[model samples]
Target: MLSLLDVFTPAAPVWSVDDLIRYSGSPPSTCYRYLKVLCGAGFLARVANGSYVLGPRILELDRTIRLCDPVYVAGTSIAQHLTDSLGYSTLLCILFSDSVMCVQQARSRDAPPQLFNRGQRRPLIAGASAKAILAHLPLHQLRSIYAKNRKDIASGGLGSDWEHFKRALKQIRSDGYCMTVGEYNPGVMSIATGLFNRDGEVLGSLAMVAWAENSDITAFRTLTPEVVRAGQEISARIAATENMMDLPARAIG
Candidate 1:
């Protein structure tokens, strides 16, 4: 069904049955069957010309994501402000199992870095954004992630062994942030810190990417305090939002 949606884009919003069949790489019968099901569910709209486009269901899902996603609600302004103030790009990543997903990115420039953007997903075993959240995750979860990705963990210099990985995480926790230079992108550096929810669970990571060629590694250290402050501010706001939503339920209980 989603394959049918992928057939339409901003430049070309409408697709005929042949277009859908071609783009979806499915047979005509299967494409028609899926299109019929999706149209019946209000996920696609059919025109008199036999072309189809996204229907109300996509809008409903988009609205739900905008309103219900905590990071988007609390971190957007903070990230945008930080990017504006710093003249650098900032990213907000959500913790999704062993993957760190770039759910929101706040950058002012017309030409942004091509690596991480909204909806980009990367492993939690590398980069400051991933490491920052990993540093704050519960012990059991961290252990499980490390157990599954031992080679990646070792390659990232986090650890070759369990004790070493634990120590790396401990240091990150003590410093209150994680810093990596030329780790993910050569001549590019990133600093990141964890965001927490109302219950103090690790919710996500906030990161800023800067060009190392322009800014020295030592200069990157200067960004730590403000970046951390922005992350904490977003975290607090999200916590308040969650707490308020839980308040009514608590009263009922």
Candidate 2:
């Protein structure tokens, strides 16, 4: 059921009971019962055509969670600063168990037409923000995520240039930042760096996205340091939070 929540949350407004049943590997009757219960509890809603969409309750919960999210609280100012300084939209994203979830986003006064918003999800292999987080993930875990999301990769929807992607991740790990162009969206470019807690566990990534027409090598050079600094600042703030105090202990064990 929790898995259902994870799947549905990321895919809200576009999912159906059949998809849920297929994903969960549950019997039709069981899946139907679960969906009925979820709808009754205001977790899922039945649309006009019989498709299921996420209910208003989920939005209320998401709003509350976003407001209280430690990373979002810590990164909001930095994201705004980056947007103001770079004249590009900035985003803060965290890997929520199996998917990368946007927590906060700020658009520059000069943001491009294709700029994305908070709560958007991008493939882990398709964008700089996702690559930044992926670079910090343990090798085994990264491989596992790739294995699980292979279909998205193979369909050319996630920019899965296997060799190129792997090499880029290696470079990101070594350089402490990631950059992408025309991977997720054509004519869109981004640069990102990972944020970590005191224990060095990755907490999230901070990214700056701009139109390709305005983004050149010079722009990358200019934004790289600022992005890295913002990531480091957020990491330090997260490290100081009480919730992160046990991270090191858990890592050690």
Each candidate's number of clashing pairs is: 0, 0
TM-score of each: 0.76, 0.75
The best candidate by TM-score is: 1
Candidate 2: Cα lDDT at 136: 78
lDDT of each candidate versus the true structure:
0.81, 0.75
Which run of 10 residues does model 2 get worst, by summed lDDT?
Answer: 244-253
Q: Where does candidate 2 stray beyond 4 Å? A: 1-32, 46-53, 145-168, 244-253
Over 4 Å off, model 1: 1-39, 42-56, 108-112, 242-253
Specify the highest-lDDT model's number.
1
What would you estimate as the lDDT of candidate 1?
Answer: 0.81
Backbone clash tally for model 1? 0
Q: What is the RMSD of candidate 2?
A: 5.1
Native-to-model Cα distance after best TM-score fit, residue 81 in candidate 2, in Å: 1.5
